[model samples]
Target: MLSHHIQINDHPFHYLGWGDRNDPVILMLHGFPEYSGAWAEVAEDLSRDHHCVAPDQRGYGQSWAPEDVNAYRTGKLVGDMVALIEHLGSRPVMVFGHDWGAAVAYALAISRPDLVSHLIIANGVHPAPFQRALAAGGAQTAASQYIHWLRREGSEEQLAEDDFAKLSSLFGASMDMGWMTPERRAAYLEEWRRPGRMRGMVNWYRASPLRLGQPGEVITDLPEMPTHTLRVRMPHLLIWGERDTALLPEATEGLEDYCDNLTRVTIPNADHWILHQESHRVAAEVRTWLKRL
Candidate 1:
């Protein structure tokens, strides 16, 4: 793998690249509290046949982290990827995003389907079903209490306190931590400790328009999703970890309403961090899925 920094939209963006430039492109996107290294293992496994690029993504790792919360909005986030793709060349690319990155990927595909060849969503949600589940007032609503806390001002300070004690705790909050070794932990800590990075990461939650519902209460007057022009027409694959407590299975229900060609896969034992917990298995499944496409 090689590391490089390029200016996109007049901002310095850092990314890890694997394989030759002539190969098929797969732009991997990491979620919250994770940098490009989150895709290290998976990128390595696929680099032999594909050109894999995973960027720090604005607020995490070595990328540019604008202090303004507005910089992390969905449209801007999607624009970054669009600019990255244009910078790479005018070729259609496959996109694989986890967690928050998945949300951005969905938006990118929806906003400009011509740029994305295939959409791969791992343990993430589409806006419609996700918004419904978030406001459903049950276990899902209860599971998402942390969202409110992370959205508060000075929340980054709280996460950065005591050497990121709260941030570290998040990895094991709803999933196993066996995949995160000491070396990996150190790398993640290094990324989190970067000046201004924590605030930028949390800004994603604050800028999001999605809201969580109260448990056992009726949720009304929620903003309606776009009935037209919000559909994902490209072939899409959703690999879900059934054991994920953070984003429960219900969050993905009715997702077909927004996707035209959607294929769903369930990993019974893996949790939210399935990319690491079952690297080879996930990689193999992705390979097979791509072959069928």
Candidate 2:
């Protein structure tokens, strides 16, 4: 893999690139507390036919981490992606996002449709459903209690004091055992040990109150761009792990309301960390979709 840093405004974002530069681009965004390396297996496959770029989105790995909470907001995160794409010569790129990265991908497709050609969302739902669930005050709220804890003052300090053992353990516990293998777990631990990385990862939750609370006017309406409209209009694919604890099946209850061209798949006995647990299957599915696209 080829690695480099691209300056997005004031912050320098670290990214890993694979495949030929002349090939069509696919930008992969990883989730919170995880670095760009999470896309290792997937990118290796996709890079054969596409220029795959996986970035340590803002707060993880070698990416720039701004101390201000607002810097981690969804809007700003999406903006950083738009800037990165522009920096890469302003071509329309397909987007693949997992977990929090999926959320950012959704926002990017909606907010800047011209920049994204297609979207592949994994293990996460649209923000509207997430906000409603959080506000409804039941299992959804209970499932998301960790976000509340992360947003609390000094929460980062506490996690830091333990040398991020708790954070690593949390990832291991939340994911399927098969997914968090010794090698995968070690990779995550190595990234977490980087200076100020934990705080930056936690900041994603801290800065997303607007979407996490309620759908504001900005996102309430369908995106004006052709790619941002309802499900039937955009070319899309959704891969879900049925055993996901944080995002229950109910969270996807009304997803069809937005997607135009959509295909949904459920992996049996898998959890939130589907990319790791079923990396080959995920890569095959993505490869098939790209061929169709």
Clashes found in each candidate (C-alpha, N, C closer than 3 A)? 0, 7
- Worst ten-residue run, lDDT, model 2? 214-223
Q: Number of the top candidate by TM-score?
A: 1
- Per-model root-mean-square deviation over C-alphas: 1.0, 4.3
**Cα TM-score of candidate 1:** 0.98
The sequence of per-residue lDDT tens digits that candidate 2 reaches over residues 72-140 is 888789988999999888478889999899989988987777888888887987776666566655666
Off by over 4 Å in 2: 181-183, 210-233
Model 2 TM: 0.88
lDDT of 1 by residue, 111-225 (tens): 8888999999899989888888888887789898899899999999999999999988976896888998999999999999899999999999989998886676547778878
| Window of ten residues with lowest summed lDDT in model 1 | 212-221
Model 1 steric clash pairs: none
